[model samples]
Target: MRRREHESLTAGPVCPSTRSPRYTCRKLECVFSLGHPSIARLLTIKLGSGHAACIRFNRSGDLLASGRLDGTIVIFDIETNGVARKLRGHTRQDWKCVLWDLQDGSRLRTIRFTAPVFIAELHPNTHLKFVAALFDDQPILVDATEELVVKRNFQSAPKRSQLDMDEATEKILAQDAKQTTTVTTFSPSGDYIIAGTNKGWLNIIETASCQTMFSTHMAGGVITLLRFAPGGRQIVVNSSDRIIRTVHFPDLTGKNVDFGNFRLENDHKYQDIVNRLLWNHVAFSATAEYLVASIHMNHHVYVWETAHNSLNTILEGPTEELSAVEWHPYKPFLAAVGIDSGEVHLWSVIAPQKWSALAPDFAEVEENEEYIEREDEFDVVASEELTKRILRQEDEDIDVLTIDPVKGYGDHQEGGFKMPVLLHQDDEDSEDEIEAIGAGQYRRKSPGRGRDRNTANEATHQNGRR
Candidate 1:
């Protein structure tokens, strides 16, 4: 078996980036064509305003959202090639967590804390609950069900923390241990919480109970990002230690299971020991078969295939260092932001069009071969009608070969697909599809399914969105 079966959402709320491709350069980077075609061309998306800090694509791969350094997020409509909307908000200082509504750019609720917060993430399954990394103490699970009264939840998540100890002991340990969570995130399924600390400790906590399930030491420096593959069986971790570890979970039963004992292939770890380069940001291909990361202060983007944990390709571009990098949700395409120019660079395979199948007389061969021409091949003097023809055949339909060779049978159900869905909501999984997140990581355009759904979307979005 390749993956574990898990619940899915119809168009899981996703965060946006893109428009048309403008040829920037002729230089192409490719190697082995591993699993997916190597990116053959470059496309550029330039926003007149601020530099892009992050980006995302809708399910159809026809829309994008680019969050800029100026605190404005511009949603680009790829179909019509226009800007859909721009989301922005007022800035504030430390010591509080505020939830803002993106639909109207309004604040939903705020949770004030005594100590400043480093980062926070909403539970994948709900909005009333969230996890926050404190600048002073351990992370906590907050329940904000008190928002109905239209006031902030006075009780911050400090009490509901992984260090679920009494007030006195918590304070004493906080002074002695001084352990702080540097990075926090949720699993794709939203059932488990993965967090890392400056001490290089990797941990998995249950979202339901806010309890630690597994803990292990994996790095020597502070951990920065923890991205679960869309499939949920794998996780890629970035740290100051300069190692990119692609973690694989053979048994994905997230209950009472010992994850510390999970095995990683010999080649699963990636690092530039000589340069000790830190990976700025890392992303998994839509199929999670490939991993791409932008190196800190470097002009190259590195891609690795997971099957063997080997370096698949190194995409070279941008004279300045590249910052954020993302893979097209459903295509073998990649987009990265230039640290200096603030322009978005896109890459995708552009295969040559072939029409030999339509013409019987034409044959395409790589190398020269002696021609054996038949006499009847060139004799076409008579104009004839079809032997037995009709205006059209109602019973016949075109069957498109839409199966992605990179995807397995159960995962690529082109015929079973529903319209306007970014994620496929299913619990059954196939062996090869164990890592596939149905419909890719996208959300419906009208994400406000209801008040509850909207709340969940808005809340979780504040956390690290993939």
Candidate 2:
């Protein structure tokens, strides 16, 4: 991760008070709410219930899939604004998670576990494969394309003492005790499947071999989340104990560099924790230069630059606690979902070349101000400072943003674009200007920087060198 300078953002409109409704004045080209609204656009679809567990979007952004507590997966078509399909596979069963492939819509997969699923995810490049963490059973990697068959299962058993085994424990054991795997994710390259369990055990299985390449211990308790770095060089795991550890693995082919390291940055520590955390998510930027993670309990998200392990920006909001976070696939925007209100917040860490894309009315408002000045032909600037200050108070918790120039991710060949960073936190300033996560002030290269030496000296080099 590249180092980012922490600066205050004062350019944004002051957030409205929470007591009032947000209203936009089209003529004035300004927006004011009963309270300050941080979201630019929000579309709320009535779920069967108000509760939503997870949300996923297809590659084309045409379909939106959400899993609810009712064990049903809801699919909606954004273009038609209608229900595409309602999957009932997990409705009656004890399944913990459901995932829809962005590449194809013909298939939907669900994970059945003895325990509830904390979180699940699909590979960015594949459709048939998906992984889910089971609180009671092993994290199962299911091939949803093949009739939802289980391709590989990773079970982590908790260590038990012989003296602690009673008759009831033996009876429970005889009935087939279930194991628990708390977190799982695919490597950035999609070559490895990583999972963590309650025993502080971390396992990385090669997708092809289905064998453990790296399995190690933490102090104890379940690992809440596993995140692969953008460069795929380091794996960070969080546990029920207040600790976020970075583990480094050698080449999986039994090389000389197989080792691991961990660091605990949280202040408060719990003793003998039983239940794993529910909200655990990790995201990397487009350039794989930074990792953004939510600090448990505090309800604050910390941005960690990968270059020197420095904290970039600390993002906080009022009322709604963050449930999920995702970095833009091709841009520098970070999308965070609120758990309390089913609201999604988008934050742009970098500034786009054209800033008009953020608030559509900024340009129109500017134009109207210019026209009014021309009509009046007065040298006076509207000093509505006191009135404006009385109407909209400054937000002490929020700041204006400063964008650093970075190389934006390339567009997707299939139509859409993946922010070169899988985890997108940067926002695009405008449609034309793309936001890059960690792009710096490196000079742009010209087209003719590299010459075709072989084509120019085919005969001359062949005769001389041969």
Candidate 1, 1-466: lDDT as tens digits: 1111111111111111111111111113233254664555443343343334556664445456665433444555543444555444413233555554433434556666555555566556555556666654667667665764222211112222344454457565563366577668777667777778777777767766666666667677877777777777788888888888887745445466665464433238888877888887788898898899998768888888788777877887767667667776677666676655555666766655676768875777889999888889887554433322332454568668654533432343343322232233232211111121232232233333377877888889977565
Which residue segments of model 1 deviate by more than 4 Å? 1-40, 43-45, 58-62, 78-81, 92-122, 127-130, 134-176, 250-267, 356-466
| lDDT at residue 106 of model 2 (Cα atoms) | 27
TM-score of each: 0.61, 0.52
Candidate 2 Cα deviation (angstroms), residue 295: 3.0
Winner by TM-score: 1
Candidate 2's clash total is 36
Location of the lowest summed lDDT over 10 successive residues in candidate 2:
6-15
Counting clashing residue pairs in each candidate, in order, gives 5, 36
The residue-by-residue lDDT of candidate 2 on 63-151, one tens digit each, is 44554433444454543444555444444335444443333322254445555555566654565566666545566666655664665
